[model samples]
Target: IENSGDLIRAINLNGGSTMEWLVDRGGGQQIITVTPRFDQDAGRWLVGILTEMVGAHTERRSNPPWVALRDSFVNTWELLVLVKQGMSGAFSQGSAPQLSGPIGIAQIAGEFTREGGLAGWLTITILLSINLAILNILPIPMLDGGRLVFVMLEWVRRGKRVPPEREGLVHLIGFAVLIGLIVVISANDVLRLIDGRSFLGG
Candidate 1:
């Protein structure tokens, strides 16, 4: 009964490809034949459904106090999972970790403002802190990980150090590229802000 809505169809499977469902949702129990749909781009069979269930009584107005801590921990863990997938190139076709600059940041902040204003800002801040900490651990030049790489190299060579000038040059080049990427992403963000559409190539 909780799953009833505007009468979205339901599916029943018995550990095989065969399927059945109930379409009429007026508290009737008549079952009907349902079929999964296939799409070309996504290349998957979708059993179209809205699975969310709401309470029979009035919904709770606010969360319990303990929910705050639980939510924070759960959200942080979810971010960690995404970060791991991102590092593994799960989100990218070309193996580059996608970067968004200040403009994207501002748009996301604006979204949070709509959700709960001050509370949303606090959540964004915590999320950003965790993301930055994870990014800082990557072995990219001009970052903490880059500096650690140099130290490791020296250790491998038993104190024979590479010239500071060469290492400095590499860092300078990497920093310039990073700045260029930020500029491009920021420009995209500004365009998105102006037109209210993203550069996500929709």
Candidate 2:
């Protein structure tokens, strides 16, 4: 590539590149080996004037486990907050949060894989786990949080407990609502994808 930015993006300059150069004289064409010159100034470097081959290989080191876990937590927490805001109409004036179901999760997982490979998969997995953990603890019927609600009520009553049948019915209805919500969100995800919309601004 003639442009340094292109070269850097194609591969790290510190790693250098093995390029084939074509030199043409009236007699014929000849191929030559060319090496890129490194510059201290950012984006101020050249690889070749006319290049036949422009490529390089790189070895990426994944972040340490602790760092990865920490980052995953931060990212998941941010995502949860964004979801909450979107659900609460916080972004009704700007970018809306992209709520996804199974299909959306799978699509996003594929994207993460394309962008970052195994690390992406691991990161998304951890984030999903975090989402599940937080969501399950929310004081909503059919969730662990819902059960906790009854337990708290029992404590407040000193010794009395809510009837098991009533609790079960409440959770049963909640389960149905959760399932219906999932179906609706999944349909939305499919529609958004069909319309070629941006998930970030959905």
Candidate 2: 10-residue stretch with minimal lDDT:
37-46
Q: Write the per-residue lDDT of candidate 1 for residues 20-129, one digit (tens) a residue.
A: 65455787687866564432232223456546655555443577889978977876786686555444432333334545688787777667766657987887787778
Candidate 1 lDDT at 17 equals 41
Candidate 1 clash figure, as a count: 0
How far does residue 61 in candidate 2 sit from its true spot (Å)?
Answer: 7.3
Pairs clashing within candidate 2: none
Per residue, candidate 2 scores C-alpha lDDT tens digits across 1-202 of: 5544345444332224466756677889999776644333322224545444447455456899999899867766666654453343324334333468998888777777777789888978877787788789999999999999999999999979999999999999999999999999999989978997645332
> lDDT of each prediction vs. the true structure?
0.64, 0.68
RMSD for each of the candidates:
7.8, 14.8
* Cα RMSD, model 1: 7.8
Query: Candidate 1 regions off by >4 Å?
Result: 1-75, 86-98, 198-202
